[model samples]
Target: MTSPDSSAPLGVFDSGVGGLTVVRALRELLPNESIIYLGDTARVPYGSKSPDTIRRFSVEDTQFLVSHGVKAVVVACNTATAHALPVLQATFRVPIIGVLEPGVEATLAADSCERVGIIGTAGTIRSSAYQYALAMRKPDLQIHATATPLLVPFVEEGWTDHPALKSVLKEYLKPLLDKGMDTLVLGCTHYPLLIPVLKRMLGNKVRLVDSASTCAAHTQRMLEEKGLLRTVKSKPTLEIYLTDLAEQAEALAKRFLGTEFGKVKKATL
Candidate 1:
């Protein structure tokens, strides 16, 4: 692959609109850089897919981004990051950033607690990706992981304050709370949308570690290190593509970005 010029837009891909949270962070931190975002909405909730399928989808997504001449790619989906990051990095020429490491680093940095909790889709929690990452960094850390699969659908439906949300939150978090976890890692990108409710439920005693901002910070540092940082003052453009046409995606994206995207085109991949 030819070297990507600094002017090339950064590529961000997720299984669905959840990745927009990462895009939101990127826009805030790297305002001058343009972005191309891809959402595989047709086969979303990748939390249930097998590793092989996830890897294949991730490869195709990366290929799509590379075809657009992006300087780097961000695997904004937690399941994809957990399953396919190494393969994507080894195969792709440009820098590929995954949400896992940044989230893990932030989780550890938040507090020096041996009892740490993690919540994500069933696939993410079952894969033990966060657990392994944390153990590698601190072998003594006790991991309490739970799969809050319903939260993803709740977030997708824009049910931030639905009457049923609190009940589910309590059910999913009580175990970790009982374990006396001082830090909790929102393992899935969709989980960040529930931050306010999560904070209210977890309270101030438990620190929440969100990967969105940390991942953006990591991307900025990496781009700077590689001399690929965009510094031009031109208005940064954001182009979004999704595998399926979803009206909800646009609305959810606005929720993440705090502004409506100029366009949301349907795509096949």
Candidate 2:
């Protein structure tokens, strides 16, 4: 395998369009580094899948990105990261980073983060990846985690402002709020899109730690440490791919990526 140079694009993959949030963050933090994103839209919700299946899909996704000569791979999906990160790191030579550790670090770094609440998909919550990581770092921290399976579909459907979404958010967050959580960790990449709504509901008391931005920061540090940071001052590029393109794929991608969205191609693995 050819070693990726500094100019090589960074690879990011998710179970679906939600991963674009990480792409957006990376674009803001490291504008000179190009990126290639892959969304496994055909099997969109890896959240409900078994650990073995998630691991298998993640490996295929990494292989696709590595084949394209990415300097490193970012597992932008929380479910994939929780279940498959170890396998991916063990199997791949290129640097493989995930959203879980960055999110845990960010959560711990928050001011007065004693009582923490984590929200993500069923697979992520079930895996105990976030909870264990947090506990390992700070044994006394209080961590409450729950699966918010509905939010991803709601966001993908472009229903961020739907009244039902707010209701669901309230219902999903009530227990954590009642527990007096001072910091909320958006464990899934998709959860970043709901920051405004979350802030409004949780008010100024709860600090929100967005995994996308934290993961991007972690990626930047890893690149710099490895001497793979792109130093060119030219315009950075973004390429998007989806295993099964939905009619609303571009719209959803735009929602997650904001103004950094671009044309998305169809990918097969």
Candidate 3:
């Protein structure tokens, strides 16, 4: 229950390799801080799971990180954040953060963002977490939310530039675009990988609020507030763990984490 040392690595978890995007952002924003990342590939796509199951899985994920003596835990999965963030925070003494609120905050912070559209996994959109958070802050904000369940698989398959992906994206975004959405919130961690394609389709007018970068910024502020920012000047380390290491995990990790990708260990949880 005591305060974790600033030198301890920051913990981050996702249902799969998608959370590596958040890790990539954190590395850029807080270069001095080390990170411990866990990808629950064994139970990938928490989006379709029940709230109770997601919560239980999330608790186990947090416990795995806490066992490693992390300073703070970042729930990098939108589905888990939507369903289990409160319980994780209450159960664990370490400062816990989620991608949901940061994404909402980033969306509202966009200039001239009147009509906002949010896209995420089925669980995230179904939970209405981003919609509710945005509404709570700006009651009059026009919001359109939908679950783009197919996008995740496409991204994982490394088909970002495939013609089929374009077709699917067009289909998924039509309703939101028709609603005159000026800004779009990529609610899931996996969605950032689709940004280049999304921008190509939506153009410069529709601002994209990426949860990965927003969450990293939020984490930096929280660490500052709690005096948990690492003071060491040496090169920071990154430890990658996965519940089930898929054959393509390394390539996928590279795709998500960019230059920060490294050896991924198999985690029991």
Error of 1 at 8 (Å): 0.5
Best by lDDT: 3
lDDT of each: 0.89, 0.92, 0.92
**Candidate 1 lDDT by residue in tens digits, 156-263:** 777988779999888888999899989988988887888998887767898888989889999999999999998777888999998987777777878876677787
- Per-residue C-alpha lDDT of model 2 across residues 163-263, encoded as one tens digit per residue: 99999998999999999999999988888889988888888999999999999999999999999999887887889989988877777888788884656
Candidates, ranked, lDDT: 3, 2, 1
lDDT of predicted model 1:
0.89
- Name the candidate, 1 or 3, with the larger TM-score value: 3
For candidate 3, lDDT tens digit of each residue in 1-269? 46789999999999988999999999889999999999999988799999999999999999999999999999999999999999998999999999998988888886598999999989999998888999999999999999999998899899999999999988989999999999999999998989999889889889999999999999999999999999988788999999898888777988899884667899997
After superposition, the stretches of candidate 3 with alpha carbons farther than 4 Å from their true spots are none
Cα RMSDs, all models: 1.2, 1.4, 1.1
